[model samples]
Target: MTRLALSALLATLALIGVATPASAHTDLLSSDPANGASVPQRPTRLTLTFTEPVPAESATVTLTGPDGAAWPTGEITADGATLTVPLAGSASPAGPYTVSWTVESLDGDFVDGTFAFTLTAPATQQPPVATTPAPPPAVTSADAAPTTTSPSAGSTATLDAPPTTGTSAPAATSGDGDDGGVPLWVWILVVAVLSVIGIAVGVGLNRRAKRGAEPAE
Candidate 1:
């Protein structure tokens, strides 16, 4: 083979060797209620299946009802292929609910996400339940960032995440304040939306220019 071909083959082989196997420590393969699934009946228990065996320790499942209160339940358990927990029958009212969970792999990798569903809805009126959270590895990576923080050191980002406003936003009418006080986040969102629109317009104009440069067919 030519020297260039030989080098390319070696590089490809190295890349294949460096690729990690697909044995992820843990990931939710499925759920009984299914994330964002709607059902007429309230589930008696919450069942979660993972891609691989996850550790029993430090695993938490939250079933929050439409009332914004925590659903009371027994301790969560990890079976051979699934983690199961009793649903809070007491407060599982007839409305939409969210089940968020945080789990740790035996390797200490963490994952977290939320799914919503509804009870007492008509058979055809079930709200859209997401089959799963956005995705596994992505959610896992987001969860890992919060834990990697060192308590001994200061964390500006942690504190910055919370809203900076000292008071709740008033009705955004003309009478709110002298200059019509607007929330900082609202202004930021407006700027962001404008920026996106501006970029999209620029891209469209550039594409039009490029197309116009082409000769007639």
Candidate 2:
């Protein structure tokens, strides 16, 4: 009877060891966008890895921004021991953010926890520049019209006369005047008449002196 009692005690100890592990709750092992990390930009999704598998339908995640606004999340998905959920709507303001999660483990026990991270300022962007064009060039001397000059008062040619086609000798003119003087033939004819008159007078006087000498006889 003592040996039978000893066997029963050993069986009870073995059962207790098995029950202890099965009744244990799931624990979070690691996370993406890990706790206490500072990221340059907001993450698109949140992923949680646990020590044991959790049901996707029973998982619930809530994100709260620095402004105390409750951000929405998409449908939760499970892959082995990991749970992932997409973020919905626009990004939150830069500051600290809190992530709270609750899930049902394989042992049918509900577990919940909280973690926090920071969202730092992102990189800045700049704008573009403008441009302009140039102008054209100016007019040159080669593009001007042709010109003609008239003769002065000293010149013999008149303004109304048409231009001659061939070379020709210049006409004779009187000194210091536009109208001409007397001709050379007129002065020669006057000198010849004066000589004829003087000769005739000398012949007549000689005849009178000879006749007076003859009359005295």
Candidate 3:
């Protein structure tokens, strides 16, 4: 049989060179905010890198938001030839951002694709910077009061004025005999002395009369 048909065509050319690198097909060696990139922030995650080794629930990612709105991805990991996912909320609304994908190629083949990116500024949650509650601490005159200082021009400032409440002026009663303002008891004493003097004079006269009568002198 001609050397067995040349050993069956060298065993079909060594099985088509070993099945052409195991039937190739798994190429996409770099992505991740690439592919038309113009991102100023809006990419939480959506990697891709490949060239073999991607499998584990295969993969599928989708995110579209140039206002057509459908941005939801999460849970799609392949970590070996990189796949990644996660981009769920907040930060996807400023223009261009597509990134669709589908992967399962380690020779199982299912490779889908699409890519775009240009978020130039999509992260505006700035209304919280409006916290203006700090204007209440400025009433200061040294915190409002007690600072009086203004009396200097040949200075004579005796400000003790705080006693103006009503009538008061009556305290001198206790038989008031203060000599120059003499009253009551002082007059009574003077009368008593005069009376004593008169009594004494009378007594002396009586004695003299009695003696004269007894001796005719």
Q: TM-score winner among the candidates?
A: 2
lDDT of 1 by residue, 46-122 (tens): 88888777666678988887779888877888887588988654434588888888888766678877777778742
Kindly report which residue stretches of model 1 are placed more than 4 angstroms away from their true locations once superposed. 1-19, 22-25, 121-217
Which candidate would rank higher by TM-score, 1 or 3?
1
Model 3: per-residue Cα lDDT over 104-171, one tens digit each: 87667798878787898867775856666666666854344443446676544444445545988898
TM-score: model 1 vs. ground truth? 0.47
Worst 10 residues of 1 by lDDT: 155-164
Best-first order by TM-score: 2, 1, 3
- Native-to-model Cα distance after best TM-score fit, residue 75 in candidate 2, in Å: 1.4
**Candidate 2 lDDT over residue span 1-217, tens digit each:** 9999999999999999999999999999989899999998889999999999888999999999998988999999999889998999764678999999999988788999989999997434445666666666765655433444545644343244355579788987576434565666667787787788788888899898888779453
So what's the TM-score on candidate 2? Answer: 0.54
Error of 1 at 108 (Å): 2.1
Q: Which model is ahead, 2 or 3, in terms of lDDT?
A: 2
What's the TM for model 3? 0.32
